[model samples]
Target: MDVRSSHPLGQHSGSEETGNEEPEQSVQRQSIIPSRMEDVICRLKDEVGYKKSFDVVVREMTLGDTRTAFFMMNGLAKDIALTEVLKRLSYLHGENMTSDALHSFMNLYVPAVQVEPEEDWNKMMTNVLAGSTAMFIEGENRALIIDAKSFPARGPEEPSLERVVRGSRDGFVETLMVNVSLVRRRLRDPRARYEVVRVGERTQTDVCIAYIDDIADMELVESIRDKIKAVHIDGLPLADKQLEEATVRLGWSPFPLVRYSERPDVVASHLLEGNVAVFVDTTPSVMILPTTFFDLVQHVEENRQTPFIGTYLRWVRFLGILVSMFLLPLWFLYVLQPQLLPPNLSFIGPSKEGKIPLVLQFLLAEFGVDLMRMAAVHTPSPLATAMSLVSAILVGDIAVKSGLFINEVILYMAVSAIGMFATPSYELGLANRIVRLVLIVSVAIFKVPGFIVGITAILLLLCFQRSFNRPYLWPFIPFDAKALLNIIFRMPVLESKTRPNLLRPQQRDKMPTGNGRS
Candidate 1:
């Protein structure tokens, strides 16, 4: 087999033979063709590029004058450890050595390592790229790949999104090893299982689905695995995107079927409830499968607060969603048909003196609000708040004074904006905004009845949507009393002892405590 080093040319200089030398002679006799290390280095340099330094060292050795060679690729090998191992192995020079002896030497000398012998060149290259050190001998058809991966890694840090007043601060990182460590560190139970799969044909991204083996339904886990396996995309930019595409029963549905979060505590809570969590390398977010509408609205922080406060917050969020979905459309309806509203609410109708079309007024206000939001988001942090204030005051004041839009329209848009903020997930919040537009148009055409019909259709669509055969509006639409309490009002941690039955979880119990007995 032709052998080459994955290093740069001229990085290391060794004696070159004028004609067929001992190493070359041995190569011909045993069919061990040696390509110049320079050729391999050139290929690596051409493929990976020259931005980063690539170094190689080649040293000639004679084990009982049998003629052998040692090659090391720098920056790829673990510092000091590989060098020390090489130093120890050098002592075997000028001693009669066989393939078995060399294998034995590597096995006994290497620390916490495994050697995979492969004759296929392609497989050897793949292993090398995956952080293994490949060793080829003069007469052997197979090459030994040693596991000496020591890439620089950063430890997990406190979560930014799912920050909790109580519970663990540790969160998953872009690294898969660190993420698995975080889960193992927290659960520490033997039942916790992680199944790793490679996706992204070109990128070959590592994705792992983790759940408690005994507690997680095997069928549910397999379903998740199959769905993920079915994904044939080039790369998954984030775990959420993959989950969105793979887990949703209806891709067109506005509601999110999978929940993506950065907090490990939130993931831990979901796993305990028999939800499957998927972690992808290079992304901080972990995707929770078979998520219901209630899951999107619920916050882990709410669980840390008092039950009463949590329930109140949930109601507030619900009201916010209602307002977000209807406010603008209702305003448009009030303008189009003042007689349909109750007497007390009739004041919302357009002023008799106003000449501009109500539709145009709403469109203008919506544009103004959106522009302000975009400005705030795109500006630098230090200037963002100031820009928001400037844009809000300028747009509201100018549009009202110029008679281009009404004050009431501005008020309704502001309310809708506030409602949009109430949504916990940014994706879900944006979806609400889109649905609100459709609802508003319906209400404008047919009044309150149209708005009601639009809402009913949305709810119906949601009920029809599923995540891995589990209802998207589970526990709420089905009216599961226990799940409803846990969904709408944050149930005490101890009382919430079972996973959602809608998912058909294998394990029914969450805690060991039975019937509230000690």
Candidate 2:
């Protein structure tokens, strides 16, 4: 798992250019950062595959007759930043450049905000690869790393999934710096901290952890940090979702332990409530960690409305999520035992027979819905209306008339699908779909016993599940009355004083008592 294999771009050869310095083999054996300018460039050219890659720019310049090189990736460095640094470095002459002039240049002339000394070749490689600018000088064992990283990303637009009738339209973009700034713009708290981690040995993709110092639990933060540090993957192709699966230890659990959001307001809200936000580069969805089951069910739109309206919206969403998860299975269970159906609800079961078993109808319908969903994603905007019409007319109507699906079966499945779409978190929706399938399969085979057992198994799984050592089924499993009530109702911001005790936040109160509104 040590991804320190032969460098992918490296061109290993004799160090003929390293005049009067260690041989290439000797340099490779020691893996040392040498002080000689020729030896440094020689080693780097071989390691970075400078000949093979054109964008890996190594601009050799002189500061007062001392040979120096500025290393950066072409598209990553901002033109203004690079030009400013170049203008400043161009002015240096005479006695300013001497032994340890690298330190003096860094101390006085370096205009970059984040500058650090790096001596390890491994660290230097990682930094320069991650859009940072590295400065190396002759006769110096250390290099200055300028944190001038700007990733290619789209400007923040309204998030399609987490949109609100009223609030900020700007959402988290693929760029990590912009995402961090969005959260910082909201809180403006000095205690807010963004700790960056370099994940993926080859990709060296930047992952940032955002949390408020005193407000967030340090133990929780440390646990999350340690788990991310423990991730030894070559690359996270799926980005935050992959990182979530690795760090959260969610093995085959259908429930989502961590919630995701693209909106900065949502992330900022959770940070103030002692939750940690994990931002992975090239991904807009930021992972909010140590989240409970109840947390995923709540939506930001609830807070955007008045308390009464918010409570109403929250309940509607809660009902939709519950129905999406359990409605079809319970209805099928009723079909399995029609005798148990109340006289008023006797019409629920399918009245007509099909080529398939009753449970098979639900399964096929589930797959059919998924197929349509996938088709919609790939379908162009202009063709989307036509696609929907085709699906509705050909697929839905033909399936019903052809008796592959009964009227009751199609009706209930459609209802359940609606509920799934209404659910706030897409991850939770997918998980609920799996749960629904399990329940349907159980109800089909063993009738009442299988249905009971499957439900119990789900409950057990949730009961045992933990997100970073915090109970997943919190407030309900541990029975916290106040917390449960808060989840059910969106209380006015002014009335709510205490942060959740479950998070164990350093500041018990949201604001000092004197800050309360009249």
Candidate 3:
């Protein structure tokens, strides 16, 4: 037995002792499938550990007087499908597998769409572990890798975060192929492509980069592909989040570099807009690359409604987001310096100061709200109402009564919280929360100057920030009036005639006609 890293496969570093070995020796290190059945069985038993791992199944059987071995993960292999294949193979006789056994067996017996020959031993084992059943014949040099994997997955329920009043209720599930099918069902264009890339050396997680070849910039697609390939990591256990962190150089900035969506419609819409969608296996969420600040702010419901209604909803949401980030800080500033307020608005500040400072009260209230929100997530549905009631009673009523929080602090915090909840992107909401907290602290210390500096710094950060080399604050910082207008108002589908110019798409016009109206 070889002593190596605790990795389940007992995998060794390829780089180690490579310099001393000759080129031929290094090439030889990559073993091919052995010709002899006994040799193959013995080697695979030792390498894959049939006795050690309960889930790794190796079924050795005599098919048409030919010895064959089937390597697969127990639960992953579709039992019914494999049984059908085996039933066909069981009917074979000695003469059926006499010459060209591998090709004959594959072409005649195997009834699978994704079945293919794999020559490399390491790759065959990897395929087996990844739920593909690998079939090795007695005389065949190459093995037949059967795609009979069936992962445990929930039905495509509507995504909780990006739900629309009137749209497709079906959302992306954890299964990669299923998610791809959802997208394919919507976008039937021949040019739409879903290129699969296996990332994570150990995990070998499947990542699909989806884009329309005709509409999307080839350079952008290649750039994203290269970045993903360059990620030399052991695994992507956390799925898309880990991949996003690895591919996108998102430094200390709190803002999201990519827009995440569980809705296939949203993903398809982005693909039509020339933006690339990255789908990670075992995770429902798909990442839309080169996202702008306005992208995070928009919702699917806006597109579902009429242009006028959608624009109104968009404006209300925008207002909510602004109020969430700035209302508390501004209110606190006013409480600190009453002179800043105009005649009618002079009564905005707290009537009487609480035992704690206005800033501390605001911070405490924010923390309590966040705590309650998290608690609600962990709490069962039946208890959620009771939990909310208790939280409201304790934080809202009792805290003010006990002189811990003033009425104004509670009032402004509640409004701010509503705005935060109204925000479409959860990541953007969290980022804004952090910014608000920093602003609150700044106001506590430097009063007026702090608010000014904090805002300016945030604007500078947004202006400088880039998502996949594209402006984060696009149509605003770079100043595209046409694009900016579209962001502000929900443009009707017919009105949106061009692909986003920022993406540098190969095809600019979305519709057939080049004129202003069709």
Candidate 4:
């Protein structure tokens, strides 16, 4: 049924401003809601451009003897719900709404649970644009803002990056509420808080900081909160990554300051350990803060298996990560100084130098691998297999056979690439590739001293790095024997009953006697 009524165009006789309102201030910053319906409609049309945008819908109708207008953004609010609200309003009579019409309409007409009265015109407009339906009564000083936000979203499918062989299939979605619910389902503690802060000026994107009020360091939470509030950007178009750059101020560092995981279980586990999780709207990945190098090395699959199996898997991942970062550079070092290799181990270097210089061959191979990887990412899913086959069989085979690269170079590059893929954190993997290239260039230039200086420089950089004031290297750099041991070996969950000392959580004990809640 059509609920719209034609509003006769009339010249707006603006009402007197409140004594406290400053006339010198910009009209957009003014908070007062106009008492005149004509003025309200005119301002909405002029300021919000209701007449210009097709999605900006304004339903005008007579409720009893009072004229009401509902401003809504199209496709944001539920149709059936608004229809029911309108139907309820149709039952109101001139007699019942004769006195206090605004009060009667709010307490009796609207059926939604999340309704509130908003007095500020700027806030009302922001709310209307953000998927709320605002009711502007003929003579009321405030608008009734109805919360009926229904953003387009997908189901919580398993994230492609954090999939496991044995675990819950559900993962965080792009919707903020859904992602919060996913974490709340796993953690039912009343002390768990999801504090939201709006960051962007134009976009006004929501960023939630989730942590246990009692367990999490309030100072850390507050510091993060202040940083988010202090953001002066016009929009958060890139979501978490943009926020990370704004807040962390990561200058030239290639390493990630925060660990990202789409798996709710991973986030929940981090919260349990007194770490904070930041959930950004429109992104499935949740950023875990105060992350160390070891945290990036960990995978949920390790915890899914038995203690011994988990330890084994952790060791293998460690080995792969090490190889991905240093294997190519170290192998090049041996080739540069063949005497460094024992007589029995001298078979490592290539038998014959290729047409290209040895250093140029490595650089070319790295660039080609990165190019193919990017091409595969952009390629259609159906054609990805063909692309891979062409890269491996046509490009790789032709290059090696033509002596553009020796057989050993191709083999080592492939091995390093495989190790890079095995890395759990994609950001860390890319950072490792950069480090490998740095080491390779150093070895090519200054030989032995270059390799030593390169390794020492990288180590010192990491040693001095900090994530939210917590040491980035953590257990290793600070020399926490027990924590380092835990990193080296995956211990049983039940046996490990204390939170990380680095976070300095308010609550140190994880397994308290009564139901395990703070």
Candidate 5:
């Protein structure tokens, strides 16, 4: 009916308007739930399974002489809060509760945090299923929605992928509120906003768009909101990744357009830089939009160290990423075209040809590495290390020694795998693996031309890849020397003043200066 767009972490703009019916028609049409309480109960039995499901609890009680029922899922609504609510409502001793008494009860009696009214079945069902307690009163035109949601979640722990040696160990947990609180705990800015949007027709998943109102680009924020609203998925069982596919629309691109972080400090840092954080419910990882190539390549460990050490770390990481992408391709070239290598470097190519051709060797090696990676993921934690060691030592050594794979092939493949493991983003690493395989195949087929063409094609693709309409290559393709240098080197926090120019943030100043614009 009435819909609006407002700031995040605040009251919503309104129920997002779908435009199926007029605002007046929304109230006039009682298609799903009837106006009468008894009819509503009957509909719940037939539609919402009030009796058939054991977990669905409908607690009927007399409220101020009015027949009332509280509907909530068993595990979602907290027992203590529900008990408190029922106890307080039992104190009502007057005649049937008028509309005014119901309003008073919602305002004064219910100590639970969130309370709202709903009439439509669509909105009511969404709230009821998403851990909120729904209350229906006899003779009332609307039903009460009390926020009594509780989720099974673990305490924040260090992220397995993005762990820092010297920074805060507390990372985001599965709970949306806890994750938001983690960010708010670090970022106390008054302008910091977290706008909530519910996606998924069946799941009714809550996705929060977080940014600083003054510093973030309004267009960027609006773009994310509009795209999220357009997501017509029935459910987002995969959570953030599913939402990413819907919004980013990154069709066929192996590279990640959005950066994901489980660390709160990492999220707060991104928000301050004018990037919006898209938080999906039931997920610990938050997605940072308008990310560049450098964002995925970077790790928080660099920032945790001193400036000089941080710069060294950043450079080392960049080198590792480069090696992961190109080392195998270059090796393939050297093996085929030994004349291209200098006398000193000519020794780099494989000395002995194995039973399999170099091309097949590279392909099989790629498959083996990926197979081990997938196996490590599914393997138990205690055995993962041992399994990896056995696979690397026994399997790799035996393959090479038995002439199944040449010694040089095994060595180079192991080196490439090491570089891949050193990469900060697992998604990016996997993408690099695919690209590496492509390069190997190309070099194997066309030798010199394939090597050149493969590199050029990848560069063109990176240049074309857009992150929320911003250049994914950023300072490289568009060429901002200063920004590019900053991405390569970790500068002290105090030295960094201007927000990313690419974002076109409303407020350029990070420090309190006269606009602080460069």
Candidate 6:
């Protein structure tokens, strides 16, 4: 179905009487065209109600004494800079002044003036909202767009999640210009490229893609550009929403294809590796495309810390991920199939029998754990500690004493919850929770064999998943030995010379070692 015709009103057909009244309608339509144009502007203004949050200003300008009207949003505009431009515009003395002449005057004569020639009125209006001043001519179809953007911005600050001890602490900010500067500051190479794209129908938010010109693959850049262009939304509420929708090959998959980080070092690393980093306006998080499962697990801090310590931490994280997904399910399977377990392991079950069914007992324990976690996350910091104590000590202890849940099940659930928190990305942690339930159901139905099969299926699905033609399980399934070593065990910063092979970056080497350095 055509998107335009999908609306309920558009789907409804006109009556035969309405069709018969076409002759009269044509006469009325001919008379109403100009009025309809006025009505269009009126309705647009009505729809965008004059809220105090938005400062709407209607200013009248005279070029060569010819009166023209301009509308702009205050506070969003650089009033001081705009005043300078207006001072120059108001002093026009020539009667033969055309739009082009006025544009030239503004460009050449006015300080810090940017002129966009022969622009569409609607697009120009969007620019106006984005802090550009628009100039309209009486007879011309085009308008002049001037850069007067003056929204307040702060410099990049230290990243909270991706803190690095040795590397740069600076991270991307909400402002696009500031973010671009941050990247440029780190990478002074002339080959570094930044392309800004406007997204969102109503928001018209600025999204920037940064990469090294020689290092980044041309096709990869084009693919990212196309995906970003195709997004048609009112506003990009979060960078993740756009990145998730654009990067995912299989939208239904729980695995994340694109890696998100707040650290500029990580983004710079990805850019150096040939992956495109998308920086959305009003969001600090930068998204790296064509990422693998390992990318999300790796951190910039790994490169900063001692190689041995980093490797140990990586292994610990991997183990945590495993426990988070299987601990509870393993307990469930143990309860269901006590005979399959080794002779010594069978004695682990509670001594006292619980009145609730084993599955129900596990479910109730899981529910209470999840509830406590949710409450802790949403609650204030002071209340969070109190709630945690109440839930962990009072609720959990009472449930165990009442014989509603087994102590072993509760213990496993708590351990699994802690393991889930070890994951750096919140989205991946949520996916882990979902996969845990699937593992539990599989074990309940088909015992240990079912659990293994379900895990195999998940791995197969992950192996099949792609992000912009790059494998989702990079450095693992495709088996790049060097990349795998780097991913599995942290490589010394100086020893690592090449970017991840999965991205297929144009440039292979990031740095060259001097002789005798080792």
Would you give me the overall lDDT of model 6?
0.72
Give residue 60's error in model 6 in angstroms.
1.9
**Model 3 bad stretches (over 4 Å):** 1-23, 26-30, 513-518
lDDT of 5 by residue, 15-124 (tens): 33554445534444544345578887888898788889999899988777777888899999988989998887888777535557568667767777889877666677
Candidate 4 TM-score, true structure as reference: 0.94
Clashing pairs in 6: 215-506
lDDT tens string, model 1, 1-518?
22322221212223224553456434333322234444444544554453354454344554433344443455555656666656666666444355564465456544435766655545455556555666655555555667776655656777755566776677777777777777776677777889988776666677899988767788889888987788887766665576457545455767776788877777786787778898887777888877877788777778777888877877888899879877788767766777778988766765653457776666666666677777777899999878877787876787678877667777788899899887787778878887887777777677778888998998888888877787777787777988787767777767777667876767686666674311
* TM-score of model 2 (CA atoms): 0.90
lDDT of 4: 0.88
Taking the tens digit of each residue's C-alpha lDDT, what string does model 4 give over 1-518? 11111111222213314443233233423556777889888988888887898888899999898899988998987777898899988887898775777788788778988899887777787777778899999887778999888888999999998889999999988889999999999999899999988888898888999999999999999989988899999999889999999998889999999899999999999998999999999899999988999899999999999999999999999999899889999999999999999999978898999999989999999999999999999999999999999999999999989988899889889999988998999999999999999999999999999999999999999998999999999899889999999988889978898899999999888788787554
TM-score versus the correct structure, for each prediction: 0.80, 0.90, 0.94, 0.94, 0.92, 0.82
- Give the total clashing residue pairs for model 2: 0
Local distance difference test, each candidate = 0.69, 0.85, 0.88, 0.88, 0.86, 0.72
* lDDT value, residue 316 of candidate 1: 88
Candidate 4 local Cα displacement, residue 154, angstroms? 1.1
Per-residue C-alpha lDDT of model 2 across residues 1-518, encoded as one tens digit per residue: 11122223355453435563345545543444667888877887898977578888888998777788988888887668878888988888867765668778788888888999876678888888878988997887778999887668799999999989998899988888899999998989888999999888678888999999978899989999999999999988779988887888778787888898999999999998888999998899999987888988888999999999999999999999889888998988887789989899887777678878887788989998999999999999999999999997898899888877788888888889999998888888899899999999998899899889998999999999988888888999988999899999899998888888778888888866564411
If both were scored by lDDT, which would come out higher, candidate 3 or candidate 5?
A: 3
Task: Please provide, for model 6 over 478-506, each residue's C-alpha lDDT reduced to its tens digit, 9 standing for 90 to 100.
Answer: 88888888878887777888777777766
- Give per-residue lDDT, candidate 5, residue 386: 100
In every candidate, how many clashes are there? Answer: 3, 0, 0, 0, 3, 1
Q: What is the lDDT of candidate 3?
A: 0.88
Off by over 4 Å in 5: 1-28, 31-35, 95-99, 514-518
